[model samples]
Target chain A: MDNKTLEQLKEKANIIRKDIINMLAEAKSGHPGGSLSAVEILTYLYFKEMNVDPTNPQWPDRDRFVLSKGHGAPVLYAVLAEKGYFSKEELMKLRKTGAMLQGHPDMKGTPGVEMSTGSLGQGLSASNGMALAGKLDNKNYRVYVLVGDGEMQEGQIWEAAMTAAHYKLDNLTAFVDNNGLQIDGTNEDVKNVEPIEDKWKAFGWHVITIDGHDFQQIENAVKEAKETKGKPTAIIAKTVKGKGVSFMENQVDWHGVAPNEEQKEKALKELEVRI
Target chain B: MANIATREAYGAALAELGEKYQDVVVLDADLSKSTKTSEFKKKFPNRFFNIGISEQDLMGTAAGLATCGKIPFASTFAMFATGRAFEQIRNSIAYPNLNVKIAASHAGITLGEDGASHQAIEDIALMRAVPNMTIVNPADALSTKKAVEAAILHKGPMYIRLGRLGVPEVYKEDMDFRIGKGILLEEGKDVTIIACGFMVHIALEASSMLKEEGISAEVIDMHTIKPLDEEIIINSARKTHAVVTAEEHNIIGGLGGAVAEVLCENYPVPMVRVGIKDVFGQSGKPLELVELYGISAKDVAAAAKKAIAKK
Candidate 1:
């Protein structure tokens, strides 16, 4: 990523956080906590990295992205709309009936979405396929997959992890949105995924721990992933749930329930000043 | 007229796909010989993966490879692919709508000596249950080739069902194949015979037999079961007044069930389903198993006769 482009992306990522919260607030039915946690990761991928042409969404050689933690779709929609994959106007239509932006990312409707992922553990495996395909086709494009910390508890994720590491998909990068909160509550309260990075490393991934909200850290980790050879990279991003908002930070209620009108105004105001 | 096995067509098709698309990879769970993906492995050793006899692992691994940008085609018996790796196919492939092709061979009673354990009588229903899975049961060797090619080009999780024994080549190499579409063979006004996979032959033969018996029968190869060719099936039902659906599968939750579900919802036509009667098969000859399960041409003709009488 160019320094100017990186700086621009850093600024855009801050705006995305505000957009995510506001969109959730508008929908009055979204997962702001998770969405806020994954903003920087999506911004770095769409704005700085990934070989994607917004015009040619199905470019076979383009790098692929799968938002495995589907509830956090605001971050992805924000990034895709901003990157010109779709009209930014469609961002407000999220979760509304007849909207291209469904509650979950539907590949048939959404441009630049490699696969339809809403279920917890399936996204990593799909990304693993894309990475393996890149190797088979001798393509330089990488596969990026984002997973929720709570979602890692699903057994299918581990199965995919084992397969990715076993196959030596060096072109694959998986980022865990480790915000410590799930719909039920905290990750420890729901399902303890302690030693998360160690677990990924044991599964043969090149593991990296980073602050998810930090643009520089996220960018550096992705850069390291591109450098890693013969092993899939896993970024265990330690993040605060609803990091940008003061009222919703580390709060479980905001996981799925979108902010009402009053809450939306406060969130947007707080996010605008902080970033 | 019949010569080589349909599984051999799969082998040839895989080799062709590997040649055309470098990204086409094959994953075999120690069933390369049975599933006949050995040809694909020979051409693309770098793209071939032998993941032991773990069906669950095969599905997940295939999903992973697809995620990485490879169009992974995992080969195994239909029973193992659908039965054993069901959850993986559902969660990893179908749920996410990944482009993983499952080349499931030895489906239905044609699997023969392997008995009920290996026969995949419920694969169609099992796969069709998934929201976005494309359930394809190609009729003949040529149709298998076309179906395989079509499944690859189409973007999504697809299950391509193939037979074990040698079947007739019903279509020419130039025949165009489309996913979610049915191929209409013999059109008649007496009774429509909607079939898939091995039963497509039976339906064709039944059409001929029904013609001889002064009962005109419409025959359709409903290859894509999940996307039930409603346009053709409904039209056939409306014109013929009744329908006979055939397949070498269980009476419940198979092609018969799929067709019945379609008819019940839309047309409500009188139908006779000719397939396995919700029972398992015993060790026997391929033909013997097909006949014993009542999925042969004669049974289909009898079903056509019955469906016509219902009118």
Candidate 2:
């Protein structure tokens, strides 16, 4: 992509980060760390990547995305709102009882959501279906699914990985937000997903490791994924949980904890400024 | 009418769905022939996905397709879909409320010769326990078509339980069927006969025999067992003062339990649950096994009278 387009996408991502902070702060609950960490990737997909129609959200043959780790919905919600899938004001409704913006993604209630994901490792399989369908129908659309490092502990993801590889689902690309933190604590403290990239490669995916926060690197990885054929691709993105904000960054406590007013202000400010 | 099994109806409806809705796709777990989706695979080869024998992967794949604006009908035996891949259905499909219609054929004792291993007697209970899942058991080929159509339009994770063997078509082709509503087949004042799937036809036959014996009976095809047409069943039970539930499932956790739980909680009516008496099924012909388990018309009529005696 051109430098101008890249800068604009980054700007859009900052706006999404702002929404994530505001929404989480409003709900007084949610996964802020992972939400913040995934903003860059989410923004890149919604703004600079995926072929989605905000107006016709259910348009068939459109490029699909699955947010496998659904707790980080603040990021996805922000992206969807900005993209006009729903009103931007719906951000305040996040996690409210009976609200369309549920704790996790509800495919029926929300627009532009591919699956109702909150349970981890399952989204990969769903994306595998989309990729397989695209191949079967000979549709040119690509499928992207974002997963959490911690979410990888679930056995279904590997099951999907194996199936996707076996079916040669080249139309699918999965991104692992190596945020290092989960609900209880750090991923390493709980379960070791250390050999994650190798594990995916062994499953027959074309593996690419990149600095997830870097827009250019993410763009390049996505482009390279499209060029590769025969098997699915896995982009192992090393990202900071609760990125952009100083206090929230790398802190496992911030995994699902919402930022208070003061913290939100600081986070919003941090995202507004460059880097 | 032509020995059309409900499983074949599921496949036929899916094949038809593929023709109309380009976004509709079918996923199978290597039992396409058993599930009767092989016909669909033949008609719409591109939309039919064979995910090998992995039931978990099959469910997860269907959920994924639903997210991408595709309506996915996942075909598998009820034993596998609801038993093996239940977590996948709960987590991926029901949890997300994705529009993944699980068309599980070979439900209940009608799976016959396959024994207890292949019989999905507890699927309704397991699938109903999961939040945001719409459970259905269509009695005949026509109702199966309607259930499949309704499930496709329902806009949530759904389970449509169908049988393997051919049963009498109990509904008219023009009969209306909503996803969660029950249809009252016959009206009586002595006992309310509530049944679903294969038992619905049995209930109607039982009610007719009871009528000839001067024992007035109310027959309701309790098709959609989840958001159960409780109002109709409860009203009938209150009016008739007794209820009898029959299914090709176990008495422990199937339509019998689902109905008993609802009735005992709200309306405490004398109810007899006619099905497998908490025992695993043995290999036999579909009809023979159903009759052997007392999930047949004669058994249903006897159970209806037993229930009435309590009242």
Candidate 3:
């Protein structure tokens, strides 16, 4: 990618970070650390990688995405709005009664959401279904899924991993957002999920490790995933929990709690400087 | 009456459905042979998926397939499909209201010789608790085939329970089958014998016995348990004023419980439930298990007599 494109993506990522901070603060309940960490990945997929149309979200041949780590719904909502899936006004009403954006991603109500997901370790299986459908229909559209590193503790994730490889779903790509934090504490202290790349490789996945926040690495990993055939790809991304804001970065306390009005103002000012 | 296992009918129905619907995909968790999905696999090898012994993965993959416009029929033993993978079914399939059909085999104590661990006496109750789920328990092989056809045509989450034991065919192959429609097999004003699954045949036998004893007993095949035929149940309850509910499952939270819930609110008739009396089934022959669990024809007749006496 060129420097100009990289700069544009960076600016978009920072705007998404601001939206996440504001939405969580307004909703008065939601996860921030995980949402912040997943901003760039969601931006890259909705903006550059995926062949999605905001107007015709249900087009059969369009590429699909599943937020497997569904608690990070704010980031997905922000990026979708940025891509014109819905209005930016809907972001503030998230988690409110009768709001289109619920605490979780509801595919029925939300546009550009291929599958409704909040439960962890379940999205990969759905992604495999989409990829298989593409194969069955002879369409070149690919399927992408984003999973949390803490979600690896679920046994179902491994089961889905096995299914993806057993079927030889070369069109499917998975990313483990290795921010290393769970609701309780750090992933290592709560439940060790290390050796992540080796695990996917053993499960017969073509593996790639990259800096999740880096646009060039993100682009390269996706390109590699597309080029590789006959096996699914697992891009293990190393990211910092709460990537943009100074106070929340790498802080376990921000995993699932809304910021106060004063704290939100501070966070927005910090993100604005980057833009 | 022809005798055949409902699981066998389910296998045959899936193969026939594959011929008509090109996008129909079948999945199983190492129980394809027993569940009868192996038949579909044989015909549609390219569309069949055997996810080994992982029921959770089977459900998740089925949900994924449904999202991609494939009508996936995920099959396994009732215990594994409903019990082992309960959360996966609840979150992945039911929550999304996906077009996935879970055709579970070996439901209830009729799956004899497998003992309590394998028998799924609570599968119906477990499935009923989830929203956006349709539950069907066919009385015979013909009804099982019809149930499969109905499930395939209906584009939503469904659970069709089939039994391993051979049951007497209660309906003809050409009988019209619809979801949530109960079949009125026999009619009487003295009492009503409402049954489902293997116990439907027993209920018919009980009705005949009641006739010999100078009592007019009504018999109904309540095939679809959820989205139940409440009109039929309430109308029969009003006429008979007494009821005996029979099923091959536990009395609590199965056919009996469902009937009682409907009648208590609508008609409030005297009722006796003929099923496994809150006990796990031990390994035995199919008929022996049915009798030991107190779900035989004699039990249905006796329960009807008791209900009549109460009235």
lDDT of 2 by residue, B173-212 (tens): 5899997788988888999999988888889999999999
Clashes in each model (backbone N, CA, C under 3 Å)?
20, 5, 0
DockQ of each: 0.29, 0.50, 0.76
lDDT of 3 by residue, B58-82 (tens): 9988998898889999999999999
**What's the best-to-worst order under lDDT?**
3, 2, 1
Query: What docking grade applies to model 3?
Result: medium
Determine the backbone clash count of candidate 2. Answer: 5
For model 3, the superposed segments whose C-alpha errors exceed 4 Å read none
Error of 3 at A138 (Å): 1.4
lDDT of 2 at A93: 82
TM-score (0 to 1) of chain B for each candidate: 0.98, 0.97, 0.98
Output the better candidate (1/2) by lDDT: 2
Candidate 2 lDDT tens digits, A207-234: 9999999999999999999999998899
lDDT of 1 by residue, B222-256 (tens): 88887878888888889998999888888899888
Who wins the lDDT comparison? 3
TM match of model 2 to true structure: 0.85
* Global lDDT of model 1: 0.84
